[model samples]
Target: MPQTTVNLRSLFLLSPDVIFLNHGSFGACPREVFTEYQRWQLELEINPVEFLGRRSGELLLYARTALGKFLGARPQDLVFISNSTAGVNAIAKSLKLKPGDEVLSTDHEYGACDNTWELVCREQGATYVKAAIPLPFDSVSFCDRVWQKVTPRTRLIFFSHITSATAVPFPAQELCARARAARILTMVDGAHAPGLIDLDLEKLGADFYVGNCHKWLMAPKGSAFLYARESAQPLAQGLVTSWGYSERTALNADQEAYAGRETFERRHQWQGTRDIAAFLAVPAALEFRRKYGWERMRAECRTLAALTQERILAANGLAPVVSGDDILQMLAIPVPRAGAERLQKWLFNERRIEVPVTAFGDMAFVRISVQAYTTQAELDALVSALAEFYKDKGNS
Candidate 1:
């Protein structure tokens, strides 16, 4: 495979000593986007009363409008949250689960979100079902495996759009359509899908979708969004109740006068006046990506990811979790042993390479994320480091 010659690392503020291949963990912000984030913070700090009291709502609306447009969603149906975990928590806590009700999901979900659902289900006397999705996944087999786990007691279906541990993209649109036909609500944790893929929320047909702008979108930290369909909006409640809740109730009482009110965005927008500068900087992040031709960059990154996957598989004589077509910007290859922690520490300490070695049950996977700032040489360095590690472990 030919190497990608374009190098955009200088645009980011990453350290010169380390090769960053872990953009999927927490995205690195570009210099331009970081400047815009600081600008919003400075504006807010200059006059707290004027910014938060007078102009915050309008500024948030503008940011939401830009973000909704990018995600192919209505601005009224979207609300900015601190992160995707908060969005997941809001939906999980708001649902009224019965003693026998079950929420179905796969085994590849993020750990924090799994904890959130488990806690909510335990409190409500409900069951959280984790279906086993085996290796070498395909769209037909994957969808069938997930659907077979659904039962009469299943009230909702929850899964990740792009899985965290395995970095595989699920067939969410098909699953959402099937769930809707069966009268089961669908919630997708699209934490890594926003900038990695072209998103269209309405067409995708998920009832509720949560995404992180801080991951693949190259936005500042604490920037994420929750999008609910018009019908699903009534079921969503804010984690931290504040003025938005009271105002929503007041509007509900005067429904005749406040008809067509923005219920979803209004009810979740304000939460006790914290720092919203990150939320306000979403538009600048979007603009920065557009100005640099993000679509082409994403395609190039996928090529790099494919090359890296091939190199890793060849080096270790290991199989991939799924085929190359199943992945986009990130790829995961299974390692020989179960000691992911030791491998992660050794890689970071010895090679100065920043990447994730994730443990999935008894198995371990080295997940590589290729971003616009990632180059061919960096991936080569990672390949060389892994070879050295394998030789030391007597696996070569």
Candidate 2:
């Protein structure tokens, strides 16, 4: 499959001393996208009130509209947030849970998000159940495993579109549909999904969906979105409620006030007046992806990612957690759990290799993030570092 060549390295403003292979954690922005982001920032500084207060509403509406159409969603259903964390927080805050009400999810969720649900459940008297889905999962089997956690008390099914540590793409549409049939609210944390995987938020059928534009979309940091289905929109009370409340009594009218999604839009949209430039940079990112024909680029990156996993694991000192066929843009290669921190530290402190050594349960993995700019030479260097580390330790 022939596609245009992309220099993934040229996109980042990172220093030359760093060999960044951790696109999965926080994505590297393209030079062009950064240019657009800075332009918006400058415009904001030029007239903060005019840019943020006066014109921002309409500008954001347009951005949301463009983003919604791209995601196969409605403008009203999508709103901007700092990141997927904030988006999920908005949903968690809005939900009213009883003492025994259960929120079912898998164990592979991001640590912070797990905390978010845990704390929220504690306060609301709801039970948060983490489904124990085993590794090396097929979609059907994974769904079956997670479904076992659902009971009569299960009010919500919180799932991830793509997991963080494992880098596995969950069968979210299947789970969302099943939850829909059961009349259970489903909130999907699509933190790594938007550009890395194909997205159709409307068709995904989750009651609440949140994604970050920064990851894989090449948008500036703090660009993210919260999408709520028309039905679930009522559950949102902004993480910090500023406006979208009754000016007079501060009482939310169940009868007179909009029992719908107005609360989510009004409250969450204006969260104590922060920088709006990042939000405005979203359109630029989208446009950049469109111009680059990101579908082709994504396929190419996945291929490179699979190859990197294969070559690295095939080496004597390297092993892998997941197979190449299942890998997306990121692959987790197993190394000595004891030496994991040392290897990572040595590579960064000595070799200037900017990669992440992630610890999962009892496993230590050298997680490499493959993007359009990743090259064979860099991959070779990473492999060499591992080989050298093992040889020096007399482990191989």
Candidate 3:
């Protein structure tokens, strides 16, 4: 698309009045994909019995196959989940975390995921330790820093492929290799990865991974997936109760990773029935991305994001959260004053610029996420709003 045709206003379903700069929190569905999603919903509503009865299985298979191809995963190994939290919850809850077994994860994990691990570990008599990766993170040194936390009791290493608050891409390939060598379970939270990062599930080499399609993949809300390595599938279980399960009568494929051992039917696939349209729309999202040249499109998005990061930080006298290479599509920088939340509120109320100003650790910061539909002008709008917010400081 031409630069002008890449109008931020037209490409997304965002409100005409709001300048949306938070594509990272929850993805902004493109107008075309949103239309397709609505169409699928309408089709399902027209004949709930017929659509979900005879054709639901087939429809799910088609979407799964298409999404698996997009992620370079086998359809059978991937299961649809509402989001990454639920996906990881299914894995974490099913794991047999005996006493003295430690689940080492980074401090940068999303709050909800941290709670998920805490809840699961508390019940299973396991320890969940936060491995602090010093800020201004150097990816080459990240593995060693995290490795120092590991001990003979360390049974699993969990971390994010892209940190939600920090927006740093942790070097997982080397770390997963080390964990595999030690026979330690390796799982990752990849919620922000798929479309933002070049993903080859086989290459990531984690025992299990889950990410959101609604975030970077631009799918409708509630569309995401969990990918478990074939060897690790036995530990899998559904987080909800459902009829998809075979009772005590196990399927031909059964093992000890916990899928059969836990309530996979009741927990995961049988989340009781809601809108299947969002999931059914995943293939359309994948196809739209594929046909639209997603790879180059992602690269362009990174370029725009980098430009925004540079322009804003330079104007605000702040530093880049991490080097351009280490971060993905989002950048997190410390806010100039106390109460980043107040600044977030001020920015929105005064400027109509919908951006994120979140507090992480001791520092208050703004996390900026850039998407393909975004333009330099929108980024400039954000900069102007922030600079104006602190206009008396004369930084801009």
Candidate 4:
């Protein structure tokens, strides 16, 4: 671990007593970023009309520009959303589906987004096909498995860039290209990819890519984005029709003579008069990470996560879901069946360690997230707690 990360802990507001191993669930905002968030909120309160009505559009565009630069996207193609789930819903709801049409995805997708597709498919009389790609597989093998499930009925392909519970990285770029070759639309749920990995939306070539800034980017809550390729913009519609709809149409006509009238960002940017402080504070979050040498910190965090996974696997006699090189800042290790929740509760109550013991099908996993604030001592405490818990279970 980097020595600077120990000092960087003071930059966050996390409790000193609790070992926070769940940065993947919702990221902890740094003090500077949170201050900027509050400053925006205070500015909005001082003069609501001036802040929201007169100045919000320009401010939002500026923030979006900064975020676009970070993600390697065009400012016009990206729009702000509350989270990846909302982004997925926007794309899924807008798609024209019919009976016998299939939306192909993997079993490793996030549960909430999976529900969105299922509900949309049910309403449209379409089929949601979940391809079962087992772990410990290479990118080529996994892509082949998912591609084999596609048929003439498959209209769309959706999967996570990095899975939620399992923490596996899928071959999204390769799959997207294959889907394009087959004339199928592609959507990528990149909820955990933004801050964890370097992103280039244009090069990745997904029709729609959704990522959360709050999770890995160190941004405030309700800050996420959706990037739609130019060709696919017509297929996207906002969940709620608002000011962006007619306003953008007129603006597009004036600016480009209706040349770029069909835009996804314009259709979804303004949903209502909501508190957009989080969205506006994205630049601050980006600056904070840059000032703190986030790239090096991320590398250190990945090393810490791999070390922790090795220690836990050695102690528990468990197999790894993927190779050590595949693990990033998060790793999910299998635990005893029916004991995951018990162990999670015990770690929280006994050791004040906050981590997720997620259940996926017949298996239970202890997912650990390593961040700049995390330390080896905290991880050691968790390992010690788990050792005690298993010893007690053996005696009982």
TM-score for each predicted model, relative to the true structure: 0.94, 0.91, 0.90, 0.95
The residue pairs in collision within model 1 are none
What clash pairs does model 2 have?
8-373
lDDT per model vs. reference: 0.86, 0.79, 0.78, 0.87
Give candidate 2 regions above 4 Å deviation: 1-8, 247-263, 316-325, 394-396
Best by TM-score: 4
In the range 241-336, model 2's lDDT, one tens digit per residue, is: 665654443222321233333555666676666887777888888898888777777777777777766766676554555564567877677766
The Cα error of candidate 3 at residue 204, in Å, is 0.8
lDDT of 3 by residue, 1-396 (tens): 225344545767788788777888998888888998899899989987777655665677688888888888888778888999988888888888888789999888889999988888888888999888877778888998888899898888889999887788998889999999999999989999888887888888999999999998899999999888888887887876454454454222221123444432223544654788888889888777776676676666677777767777787677666885875667786657544547888778878878788656676567887766666677788878777767754431
Mark the 10 consecutive residues where model 1 has the least summed lDDT. Answer: 250-259
**lDDT (10s digit) by residue, model 4, range 266-369:** 56876777999999999999999899888888888988888888888888887878775678897787777656768788789988999999866777778999
Q: Candidate 4's C-alpha lDDT?
A: 0.87
Q: 1 or 4, which is superior by TM-score? A: 4
Error of model 4, residue 246, in angstroms: 2.7
Top lDDT hit: 4
Please say which candidate is ahead in TM-score: 3 or 4.
4
Which has the higher TM-score value, candidate number 1 or candidate number 3? 1
